[model samples]
Target: MTFYAFAKRIVSPILKKMYRVEVKGLEHFPEQGGVLLCSNHIDNMDPPILGVTCPRPISFMAKAELFNVPILSGIIKKLNAFPVKRGGNDREALRTGLKVLKEGKVLGLFPEGTRSKTGKLGKGLAGAGYFALRTNAQVIPCAIIGSYRIFQKVKVIYGKPIDMSELREKKASPEEATNLIMTHIQQLLNENR
Candidate 1:
């Protein structure tokens, strides 16, 4: 069996029992492409949940520190997670993300950059926007409500794929593209509420 399938088979049942996650909009997920799934960062479980819940395999840029853990490093790597340097512009991480997408895989990203300990969404970082525009990939804004509390009801809503073709055609600045992407994410959150 494929490693992803194995991992998902193991993780999905546990998460489902503990969190009771409700996911909507599976239809919006593109069948194939360099797609970006942009989500808010609220809880540590967010990444793993996305990996399990999404229809396609999801590759994410995890904090480099996790990779330093002896056993965890090997496990997450096998699960299709890669490390990104925490503090600055991580070019290597960006390149790796591009490579993942270029191979027509789904690249999952957290627009807020870090976990919102307060559960309040923060300004979207430029990375998701910049990457979507640069790669001409479709951005699907996702909202996870009440995921911070374990063993509670969590709702994950997937918005339609965002078309940012103009950004690529115009060669927009990363900051500008990022702002647009953040807006879409914000809209999704607002719509859910």
Candidate 2:
């Protein structure tokens, strides 16, 4: 099996058991096509939780610092995680993300760009919106509920793709697109929380 599949198979049950993870609304996910998967960032485990629960493999843009760690760097690379420089525009990272989507793959990203200490959703950065507008890929907004406290119920909710036809027609800016993405995520949080 591929590394992603292998890793998920080994880790999924462990994580599910450890956190009592409950994944909902997975039926909203598409079976094929490029997808820009956007989610709210709460904890570092958020990505892994989403990855395990998702039916498809997701190429994620992680903070560049994590790549500095030798063992973690190698592991995350194998897991299809790329490094992104936070607090500034990283052209290389942006290009990588575009390439993933153009190649008809799922590009997972945290719209807020960083973990929220308050466990509340934050305003989204333009990166998620940029991907949504630049590619033909559908934008799927997800919400990760509950802290990663051991034995606590952690839920991952995948919402339906945000309709971007109107935004595309208007040539909406990245900021505008991000607004819609964040709005859907917030709605999901409100509904699911």
Candidate 3:
């Protein structure tokens, strides 16, 4: 196995045990293939929580600023994260994400762009939708609940995959597609609540 794949396999279980995490809907993941995991962001821990809980290596797009710290940047890179500038169009980051998807790897994206302090799902940016269309990858809507509460048990609900082929065929605008995906994520959160 590749280094990241092996490291992810070994580290996830240990981290889950240490954190006392509870996860569901792992079976919803495709046994093998590329996938775009679109998740709600409530806290800084959300990414690692979802990453370690799922049974595969998830390549996530982190803010470029975070990588400026030498030690943390190295660690994040080891964990299969790439950087994206926060305030503008990041073509390079988008290209890397697409390349990962095209290579049949999982790419995790926070559609909200940043954490939601209120614990309510925020409006999603169109990047996830755009990536899905560009790569024709399956979009898996994930909802993470109770992650904002300190030391509390967290729940991650993975909804069924949404096919992007139809969206591409209809020539749906990124805004429209993003809204649809966000609505689905909200519905998943409601179901868990």
Provide the overall lDDT of each model, using Cα atoms, as 2-decimal numbers.
0.84, 0.95, 0.84
Compose the digit string of candidate 2's lDDT tens values, residues 11-67: 999999999999998999989989999999999899899999999999999999999
Off by over 4 Å in 2: none
lDDT of 1 by residue, 89-157 (tens): 999999999998888899998977899878878877778876887685778888888854678888788
Candidate 1, lDDT over the whole model: 0.84
Which of candidates 1 and 2 is the stronger one according to TM-score? 2
lDDT string for model 3 (1-193, tens) is 7767676678777656665677778888876678999999988888878877777788999999989998999888988999999878899999999999998889999999999989899988989888878876778889987744545667888888886677889988888788888988999999997
**Ordered list by TM-score, greatest first:** 2, 1, 3
Clash pairs for candidate 1? none
Residue ranges of candidate 1 with Cα displaced over 4 Å: none
Which predicted model would earn the best TM-score? 2
* RMSD vs true structure, all candidates: 1.3, 0.6, 1.9
TM-score for each of the candidates = 0.94, 0.99, 0.91
